[model samples]
Target: MTTRIDTRFAELAHKGRAALVTFLMAGDPDPATSLDIVKAMPAAGADVIELGMPFTDPMADGPAIQAAGLRALGAGMTLKKTLDLVRAFRAGDDTTPIVLMGYFNPIYVYGVDRFLVDAKAAGVDGLIVVDLPPEEDAELCLPALAAGVDFVRLATPTTDDKRLPAVLKNTAGFVYYVSITGITGTATPDFGRVAAAVARIKRHTRLPVAVGFGVRTAEHAAAVAQGADGVVVGSALIDVLKATLGADGQASAGTVPAVARLVGELAAGVRSARRAAE
Candidate 1:
């Protein structure tokens, strides 16, 4: 059950480190810049990239991500085009892992088995389907595993003690712990509470636990990394991308490099925190 993600990211945990998994909508301003953003992440220090598969109704996302998804949709970005971005990103670098993060409707529309085959072909390592809870994994999980993909799970603070083990059962890649009890982007995570939650989840599963939702700054990344196997940044990064896009509704040339530089800095913060822990 070796996955493209595990091949690249699992080793980082052995070094007392966690991956910096950043999510961004491809083609928010345009496709080429979005692809540049993807390639620039590793240069900045990202161990794995979560290329957000934008959908019209992204219930889990906050304002920033929802707006970003809308912008991407307006740019004519499709699920096919999104996976193609992953394939294009892989052409230049083979090490940094890429995962598709999205809801299930678009994939279901695209046909699950066909989507899995395309995703594998595009060099995707894993998936983070926002709506697919533990009980209904058979919809895509089994086919994903058969395609050599990791069916990642997201455990919230509400996914409590009684239901934790079942949530951990079919998870093969890693467990994404939403740091707060809310949607992506609007969170002010309780680091202590998040740390405790991570510990509790660890008691049930050996899979890496990545914390996400409201992580914005380097200091925030450092703090979250204390109990997380990875720190995921989404809205904050999208905000930066929104900034990079100019006032007149056009993508600026600096958006990709600037976004990469910021995420790289955050990744460094997480790495430095891990070093201090050791």
Candidate 2:
């Protein structure tokens, strides 16, 4: 069976190109604009789009993402609406991968089987449940994989090598390597430790590893992407969105274009890292 994410990502890996994964709230000010942001990202060099399913209590997120979540919720963004956005994005482009990033409460609230069916129908290729540990994989992991969605796992720097195998088992899409053990949108990270963490994860799995958490600039992205299969930039991007969109989370003047430009710049930074390494 051909997996949606694995196949799409394999094309990039074979060509030895770095993947840029962007994270944004489902409905910032409204669904239409958020969908527009999603649509704009692919052309700006995003290999995979991580559509953040806003939760009231986003413990893993920082100020920017939390506020984005509240705004999405206030705008009447629901689980159903998020899937609708994915369906809408799929309407225009069927190739660029879309991964739903959120907590499992909404998934369980919507019913795992039902949610999987809806997600696939909407063209979503994967999921990133922040609290779903490998030990509790059966709850949604099994159904997620069976439905053709990759249940992507997050391996933090603190994850012990003894437990890396369990975290990686049956994991597809890509392994999200959290550069730091804190919330998203922090600050620049020490790539030395990030590099070591990537090596440790690679020791156990062949899946592509994209590191995130506190990645905020092209320089930071280049630093980590030098040894990573991909670089996941969230907080920085969300920060840009917040700065441009403001508390209302609407795209500030030139905010949408600015965000797109930054994504493209960071992706180019990854390429620069590749060239320097060569």
Candidate 3:
């Protein structure tokens, strides 16, 4: 049952480098432009794509991501539209793993069973439902894995040894290690601590640990890559997209290229990290 996520991580390991995982809000500004941005990600060097399912109240998301979700929702982004985006992206590129990242409310309302079917049909490889916990596996996690979609779980800095096993219990795809304790994009992750945290989580599960939350630049990605199997960049990319938006708060001509360029730099950082470490 090797999923696309598993395969991608294994491939990165063979190359002796970390993966660059990019997060983008689905239908931000509008569906068409958002799709174009996603379509350009792999070519820009994103090893994995996390398509955020825009929910009204994204409790776990920081301000940047919260605003991005609101913009996507305002532009008519819905659970179905997000899946359609994934479907459209899959039509052209089949190898880049697409993970639906967001809170669980949208999926719950969409109907768990139905969402699973549609997501799988759309070629979604994984999911990151931030609100769902290990105790609630029956709600979505178990069913998602049953339907062949990897259910990725988040392990925070607060997840001590006593709680690590429970967090990793049903987690698939990879363990997302939140580098900071608070909301995302507020502070820089202490790379030394990140390396140690990744090592701690690795002892509990064989799943690849991807460090996220505080990763904002190529240097941050590179430093975290010294220990993490993958670097997940979300808020930073949203900030890039936001900065390039037009005066009318619409997608300008510069939006896609700007994001792609940043991703390319981050990818270079991740790929060269191992060399730097040696």
Candidate 4:
């Protein structure tokens, strides 16, 4: 079954350019503003949208993303509300793939079966549960696949050849290659090493590989886009949104525009990669 994710990547492939996958918390400053920011992403050139499912303890997230999650939770951004956000986004734009990126606790608490049903109904195309490894496939990964939602797996620098197969065994939609070793947005990745890593992973699976972590600028996105099938920008966007917030941590007039502006710049960078190659 070809999902929205598969279709989007295929479309980008045909266009000879990498995808610009944008990420943001579901209700960072406030739900209304958050929705506005998301709705503006596609027009800003985001080929794929990874909406964060804010959790109490996002172990994989960096400071910017962690703070974004806190602000979301503070504004009562529950798991259900996050799904509702997706549902609302789908009302206007159904073609843009929406991937719920976060940990697994909330899903477990909400009951995986029920969550998958609701997520599908809400038009969620994929999921990136950082905590669930390939070892625990039955817990959520396999079930998610069966439920028709792509479970995107992450591959870090530490994942050796022996472990790559297991990681890619049931992974669907795409494989997220963590360019840095630590949490999101902490360090810059060596573009050379990232290219080699993407090449190495491609040797193992036909799935598109998206490189993320520490991609802060258009130049950084361009560099990764040269080798990666997609370039993901999360922390940088969160940082921009945070900066646009008021002193009370609420969305200011500049919030949505700020994020939209950055996404546009990053998308241009990603698009430039193919032209440079040509």
By lDDT, who's the top model here?
4
Candidate 3 C-alpha lDDT tens digits along 157-260? 88999999999998999999999888877788888998999999999999999999989899999999888899999999999999999887899999999999
TM-score of each: 0.96, 0.95, 0.97, 0.98
Q: Sorted by TM-score, highest first, which candidate order results?
A: 4, 3, 1, 2
- Candidate 1 residue 21 C-alpha distance from true site, Å: 0.9
Indicate the residue-level lDDT of 185 in model 4: 87
Query: After superposing candidate 3, which stretches have Cα over 4 Å from the reference?
Result: 275-278
Query: What is the Å distance of residue 26 in model 4 from its true position?
Result: 0.7
Quantify all predictions' global Cα lDDT against the true fold. Answer: 0.86, 0.84, 0.92, 0.94
Tens-digit lDDT track for model 1 on 47-69? Answer: 77898888999998899999998
Candidate 1 residue 115 Cα shift, in angstroms, is 0.8
Local accuracy of candidate 4 as per-residue lDDT tens digits, 1-278: 88999999988898889999999999988899999999999999999999999999999889999999999999999999999999999999989999999999999999999999999999999999999999989999998999999999999999999999999999999999999899998999999999999999999999999999999999999999998999999999999999988889988889999999999999999999993322
Residue pairs clashing, model 4: none
Per-model root-mean-square deviation over C-alphas:
1.4, 1.9, 1.6, 1.3
lDDT of 1: 0.86
Per-residue error for 222 in candidate 3, Å, reads 0.4
Query: Which stretch of 10 consecutive residues in model 2 shows the poorest summed lDDT?
Result: 269-278
In candidate 1, position 181 carries an lDDT of: 81
User: Candidate order by lDDT, highest to lowest?
Assistant: 4, 3, 1, 2
* Candidate 3: C-alpha lDDT: 0.92
